[model samples]
Target: MNLRTNFVLGALLLTSGVWSQTGLVPKQFLSLPLGQIGPSGWLSDQLAVQTNGLAGHEHEFYHYVSQTDWVGGNSFYSTLEEAGSYWFNAMVPNGVLANSSVLNQKTSAFLDYVLSHQDSTGWLGPEVNTTKPRYLWGRYPFMFGAIQMVEAHPELTDQVVNALHKFVALANTMLHNGQGQEDWTRVRWPDFIMVLQWLYDFHPNGKEDLLLDTMKQLKFTGAPWEDVFSTELFPKGATDNMRNPTGFVLTWHGVNMAEGLKALPATYRFTHNQSGGLSRIIGILPLMSLFALDLDRASEGWDLLFQYHGRPSGIFAADEYLAGLEAVRGTELCLVVETIGSYLYQVIGDPKYLDRVERIAYNALPATLTGDFWSRQYLQQQNQIAAQNMNPHSRNPFPNDGPYSNVFGLEPNYPCCTVNHPQGWPKFITNSFLTTPDQKSLVQAYLGPFSTRTTLANNNQVSVSVDTLYPFSDTLTTTITAAQAFTYHVRIPSWVSGGTISINGGAAQALSPNNGLQAVSAKAGTTKFVLNLPAKITTGTFQSRPHGSIAVQRGPLHYAFDIPRNSTVLARNAQESRAVDLQFEATAAWQYAIDPSTLKFINSPPQSGALPSPIFDSNLPPLSIEVTACPINWNIAGSTFAASPPQNPACVGAQKTIKLTPYGSTKLRIGEFPVFKST
Candidate 1:
């Protein structure tokens, strides 16, 4: 019944196989090709900064607990701080500790602290000194830190190894004594699993009697798996969401649960023939209702995310009310990052998932980061300022709508996000490139730079390299090098225009129109992917406006450019209208140069100072211009900023400047463009 202890034991059981590879990975788990687009830690950097700020934070944990009775009285702050600090350090290149010496010293010091405080029961947790020292499970992370230190710095001393074994023995003891809890299910299961599996994988034939009982309780069978498709709430006292605003039922993403189910096959294998544990857990729910298992579930979630709950930047929120009520209040940065993380796991093979992944990565994900990638807003809305400042975690006020505003840090409204959010960025960067059991690889997402060696299904080792300037350039090229033959599937993005596939300097085959990947069959030589995407644009109608034409999609993003009083285009709650005629002015004007650096916003004037004004800082980036020749001239009446520019500005003597840019490029500009046709 002890969940934490059970998880430890189950991990030991799963790690029955110990294997190492300095070369190619076997053809089992798909391996992503080495590519730059998937390597950048743009979002990951933001999360790490926040994590370091909070964990050893002066008020959050370290400093506060250090001053309280909890540090030396009844709790194990010393070890928790050590474990957290070590894991946090393992992430960064130099980390908190400058070099191997510092890392080893810190690790050794932590081990010494833990060894000095170990209770006779072999259990180590929060209540290290109490009679019921076994009651706490929070200290389990220290054991995880031990394994991490070993992994990050392989030069573990004999003393370090001996110290680690003691912690493991203590963990084993806790399980034997039944000190683990039953209600604790892993929301961050993958993180713990990585360490647990590592221990068993490295020390095969180490312990069986110690892990058997714990594995049984740790399996998904006993964990509560709810119906994620429906809006069904968990029983009042049974779960966290019952408290309202805190639970996964309403607030947690269904996609995350779906992704965990999809990854069950590998974990099942890790457990060594002990199967059905995953099914037993999944069997509790309607299989058809599982979003990852059924397409309908995906459609429904997407319907809400795209059609109803979508924001201008492409992220969706799980907030109480539908988004667009107040874009800032609805979308949480954690939810945005986690949603993508889950979706990638569930549908990595599908092109649609890749499309959504790219959209969210380029749009929603970047919206939160400051221009320099330093500070981040927990939530962001269109037509709102996006700097790091305190804002209400709950609803907003007045015209913005929702709860109180200007709140900061990890508020009670939802603090789990504070911890859970960090996992997203790191995982996102790592998983972007996956290697199929066969060494052949594909580019699932694009960031910047990274590389890994992988094994293919045929057991051939291929060094797959991906190179591209994406989000900026339309073409992405992957070069595969191997001693043998291997087939690689390259995901052709849904947004790609005139995307052609050429392998090893041969005539390219035009893959199935949009969104279909072009598979490349080649040997050890060298294959190149050359894609020529001409400038293109698509138009959609504003459902609410009469004779209004709105631009729905351009390249990979949907854009809206709203200029002042004629602001029907990017106004509050603006949507696609059927009555409007949307025309793409495919002329020279449609290709204006844009300044990428000028994408920030000007602050809104304070209420007491003056009236609400629709103005932006002149210092912001200049809009990317496109000259679209329109048939009609609405500016004959002297309106300088017409919805659409006239064929000839001289007729109206209103030579107005038309500033148009990609919707994804601007966080400050009005997105919806007004539509004007005869009538």
Candidate 2:
């Protein structure tokens, strides 16, 4: 425990590819604090309570599939299998307290069904007398199942482990047998790679042949998924090699690749195989994809749904696959859940990964959910005014779009999305803490309460206990208990500039500003960290008449100056030099008053040349002659409040007063105002 440096080259860290040699497996997953958690107690409760509904559906769906179709009908089972795996993954930790037996039974039954469907040819899937012959979509069920089984039940039967290996053999053979005619396109290779990582974990023997070779032969450039494999989307036959791949870069590639990249190196270390290097190269594709998209676009490939009338509980939407950001259209549930998974892989090794993840989690995730997590829409528009029907596959409501409806249920727009969304909640909570290979415990996110225990490379035990009302408050107290004195690294949130760190209640000097500060020493028994969050504001853009300007921000929240509704804000000459000047009367916060009636906001700030130059010299009580435009209201997503300036600013000299609040607090108010400033 009395070791100095924890950094080692090529050692396995947490989930991120950076390796650190740890004596014991990591106890916590890395989590990124995206933002605030909306009041979605419903979704949380459902995941906590009614997860069985989805599990049962997966069981029934899988049960109905005949053995003959296991090979051909693999996609159907693969879909159902993923649903079951995610349900089990999300519910298992919590289910241990409630109905552990039922949870295990359902999960075991599903696995049993998958194993039963394994073909004699080592191929795993329902080769039912369907139109298609034996395919590889179903191969992942065994691969992923093997992984979940090994992780969840390390003492799993050798037969079960061997069966999974056989399934991979079948996948490899099936892929090779059909090589003469055409290459497999629709098959998801990443999923295969992920499962292979798991399969190789238990089966360290060199007996696994085709699985390794097939993984090596797989080469996907340009599009994300192999286009030809998806017969469902293109029933006749795939003419082009590209299929519709939907997801933000971080969500699809980052997490998926992180796991593989990290696992490959670890697997290589264990098996002494060079194949791990290949996986690392494959993992770089997503990073490459990020570069492929030009940097200029704000929210580029990541599509946002912007339906006007019908909206979902969440913020962004992408139901119909990468539907560009239209305020009326909606976002996809798949994107939300997948993004969480991706962030988990990114933040473990690097602290900056926390920034992007937190943005998506806090802003994008919570924006869509209703107070409780109960009903979720597949998509939500940014400019959405109210909640409407969310029925799946409904006609887009836009003039060119179809009908809008609430696709709320186990299966909304698509059954797969419904199955995938549940993983986000449980996995997100679990990833709040992570451990490095050096056995250093890192607290990447702040979510409620949790405990983690990890062993360092020296076989020393390290335990971390985090206590705080983080995100809601600025202070975090972390208690580290170690068997021996060891140095641990902790990440500093980007939002925090600098603060005092107290070890065990004693004030320690400020920490460095590197990606992560140097290791903090654990005294004889315990080491504590007390971080004070710095007061700060963030920057954002707002719309004025001619062009938009930047707005100063504090924390995650943005601020705005309250401009009375129905006041017209003009730029005058379309340039800042000739812009409309807004009259600002600072009471508590800045307030702008144009005309009390037909309230509208002026675009330019109250400065010289903002308003028509003549109005400034007039003796008209500074408010009477201000330009008037349509009224605008500032409110949260829903709570409406009047934007009218306080008690007639025109009569201010008549012993009256005007009230105001920060622009961030006011939901609806004029961000830009026009006032004539004397030059």
Candidate 3:
């Protein structure tokens, strides 16, 4: 039979449920549609600040975003397509979550232009000449943004599906013909597969085989992620130490590793064979077994990766490539967001993944961006005490990245992070709450102030609102209104020593959590649930740091010593005051070692009736800890970077009590400190 005839027959079988029973493992929780859940409380305030800052204004001042080919401009950069795609990807979620009409309108217009300009050959985005290979990597982000836009505006669904169908057909042919299967596109094929899977699951339009075939072609031509994870080929240390690392550069790239984490799991969903019923059953056994083994190996690989190179910020060192565990080495902003995306789609449904998500979001994500969101860094260090451009004479910790990588500015070192960082918070907000496959139960997968509306089984409509300052405060209150009774599940973070939940002012019940989730039965009508998670101050050591050095944490938020700073304007746009790049230098001493035992949690009343605007502002953290510290003669590694903490450093000055704020709130801060033991 011809290919078209075979696909038609397969569609018939699928519709008849003959091929519906599959080998894929079901996810414990399914993500809700975009716009169904949104930011509230302090989280909402943060998104508003983003809207008023770089994310909302990039198109106006940033030439990469403003004059890109996607919007009919004549910018002639080879990677302009990727750059424009990144901006649109971030802006869609940010606009929808922030509810900014202006941003939404801009995103809408960009989508309209791209869709309307799709090539006649079923290609999406700008068309390169036939002689030049059309790269597929850029279109992945555009499709991601387009999906979210369609979710938010259902009226555009038909147009989006039509465009996607055409593009997928073209992509399948391209993969077969080796048109755009470059290193990046090959390594990051899971992103494209995910878009294909979305279409297969939601809007197949009776072309399920075509979608599945496209996925298979892409996977066959893609990087060997499963093999990379399953074998010893996975880098156990920094990639630079490996022999001839250039050949394996793409495999060891930090952002690719983050995005590749889910590759095997995603591939398993479509590896099912559908030739004949008995043959399919026989084929499934080996595939399932291989997938199980692959999953375990992938998990172990990740553990080893983190064990050797992980940082306290819930991200591993990767200043473009995989750096080791040194506190001074920088982690890329792209790694932070992509790691969050990987965890969200990991399919294992492990609560620890959610915990990691919160850690990266609350600390590392914000630390890279300015409080006002006007500028950001390509790389951030856990022990960052300054945001100045690196001196040429300095021994660079980030060998793979540029000297200006850690400075806060517009396109400090690369334009990729500038366009890519916007997806961090918006994705967090939307994926905060999830529903079961049955749609009967709601799972509060990640903690934050957000509200959601979902329809449960039996046509039960439910709306849930969470109110509290989480990660900063100990208490969270959830109000649920449902048309019918359903169970509400909340994830109890592993960091909490103990927690209690109360129902509508009734006596509190000690939370008995299973798999890091606490479940409560709610009635058909309105129900109120209050949870108190008392977090204790804790300290831990990093492998690459001095033996006596330690990092502090309370709940999900990391604590850092906020360094006083003087800001210098490195560059600025003449047309806009907020559009400026800045360099920061520590004004006061930063070489202080603290006694961990002296740490005491402190909570201050909100300055006003509500959380402060630009919630991550250096002076506005509502929670802090007081610790006894003493000045020490900590050395500098190079001309600029702080060296490893001295082992049991001697106090050089009289000890004094100092306050440490949340890591996300500080622009220049010390997250890990040396120990100053009293004689």
Query: Which is the better candidate, 1 or 3, if ranked by lDDT?
Result: 3
Q: Return the TM-score for each candidate structure.
A: 0.57, 0.58, 0.91
In model 2, which range of ten residues has the least summed lDDT?
1-10
Query: What lDDT does model 3 reach?
Result: 0.78
For model 2, how does the per-residue alpha-carbon lDDT over 1-679 read when each residue is reduced to its tens digit? 0001111111122224432232212212422221111112222333443344333233334332212243443433544434444444444433432335665665565566667766665655444333345545434434544454455565665756777677666666654454311222322445565556445534645754455555433322112221111112211211122343322132222223222222222222222322223333555433322211111111211211112111112223334433332333445555565555433233134443444454444334543332224334454343333333323343343322232222333333444444455555555554555555333444434333344565655667767766643333456677788787766665566666666677777766676746654467776478887766654543222111111222223333222333322212222222112212111112222233322232222223234412222111112111211222222222232121122222212222222223222221231233333221111
* Candidate 2, backbone clash total: 115
lDDT of each: 0.39, 0.38, 0.78
The RMSD (Cα, Å) of candidate 3 is: 5.3
- Which one wins by TM-score: 1 or 2? 2
Best by lDDT: 3
What local lDDT score does residue 79 receive in model 2, on the 0 to 100 scale? Answer: 45
How many residue pairs clash per model? 51, 115, 0
TM-score result, candidate 1: 0.57
Point to the candidate with the largest TM-score.
3
Tens digits of per-residue lDDT, candidate 3, 132-180, equal: 4578888898899999988888999999999999988888887767687
Tens-digit lDDT track of model 1 for 346-442: 3323455556666666565544433333223354444332122223452232222223111123321333333333334444555566555323454
Q: Residue 207 of model 3: what lDDT? A: 82
